[model samples]
Target: MTGYTCTSCGEHHEELPFAYSAPAPAFWQDAPTDVLEPERCVISGEHYFLRGRLVLPVRDADQDFEWGVWVSVSKDNFFRAEELWDDPKRTDEPPYFGWLATELPGYEPGTLNLKTNLHTRPPGERPLIEVEPTGHPLAVEQRDGITLIRVQAVAELLRHP
Candidate 1:
């Protein structure tokens, strides 16, 4: 009944908009040299620094989940994830950083859609679905480098933010 306008149907409803928020770097190829606080990797046995932000959902229904950016290092690898950045502003076990020892060339930041797939894993449920970035940053670092585009913490995203 107030301050709510639909983008497609032109319907008026009452709800807070800013539900989903993403890192949204100006361009995919641009990034800051230093984004994260210095930290040691538990997996790679190396010292690395990183920074990142979460890509929030565009809809209020999607805001059910907490959101933010994440960049951390462990013995295994240095990581920057957009989807998993939950708002400890509410829960525990923030999986902010975790991975096996490995090396990452780097990545470009952008928004992504979360989905579900029933083809793999524990069955009955399709976990996080990460569609490739149409506005990717400088191609997925050399073909061999492998760009691990993934989506996780979906249910959570639909539960908190």
Candidate 2:
């Protein structure tokens, strides 16, 4: 596949990045030092967060676009996830309600605080986040899927933003 020129950096990349990720929740930046953990699971006082993926189908491609993002869940749900962290049966757990904690770039009105359902996968995979049906651009893309050209556009937008 041909790579596109980055609008921001004006550099040519060899391939488009099908996946983007936020290392931690947006709140993590302002979290107090004492309430942090050295793992993917974060418990900032009463708020709980877990890293997961929000996937969108690529209409004309064989692969899907994925965002490695964070979701804030309740304390009880957080503990339940931790308890099944390594269990293959973890996928049996029902979806957990959460709020999107990552501010995904390139979306109007921002992407934080969107309602989501975190569905547990098997032991080795991150939970799959299903954005609630809405008219937001991100949600629309998730529901209707996007073309490869759109993927390229997103790659360009995020490359140096």
Candidate 3:
């Protein structure tokens, strides 16, 4: 397997799984409500913007934490999400998807374990994830006014724990 030394973490990795593919957190269901109002960017009263730190699974031993993430939801998808936000019986809906809006300073795209089908927008257009219509225990949280998602907690949520 090919490997590269991470300049940010100084660790040798056989593969970079920076791209994360997991189920959207349930709390994302009510993005219109759950999303902090101040940080929210609403368009035409039907679309809203969701942006925050998306904690990656990559750990930095020196820093004792995982890498940083910043993702944003697309406008059209956000509108669709709003329509289904309060539907109690909308259980069969497909997962909400978002683009990979930004890139880490030193990482290359297509190397991370992110879902391939998802479209990545320009630097200003952040990546998107399907927001579950419910709350996932480990999905969303507030820290210093930033919405953060911990990779560890995400793993646990994926395992249906």
Which residue segments of model 1 deviate by more than 4 Å?
21-67, 70-72, 76-161
* C-alpha root-mean-square deviation, candidate 2: 2.1
Ranking by lDDT: 2, 3, 1
**Off by more than 4 A, model 2:** 6-11, 30-39
Candidate 3 structure quality by residue, lDDT tens digits, 18-113: 334222221235444344342244444543454433432223322222333323456766665446545643344454455333333323332122
For candidate 3, the lDDT comes to 0.36
lDDT of each: 0.26, 0.86, 0.36
Ranking by TM-score: 2, 3, 1
How much does each candidate deviate from the true structure in C-alpha RMSD? Answer: 17.6, 2.1, 15.3
lDDT of 1 by residue, 1-161 (tens): 13444443465535433323233212222234323222211212243422222232322233322233223334222332222223232122223232111112123343221111111112222112222333343122211122111112232233332
Expressed as tens digits, the lDDT of each residue in 107-160 for candidate 2 is: 998999999999999987889999999999989999999998888888877765
**lDDT score, residue 23, model 1?**
38
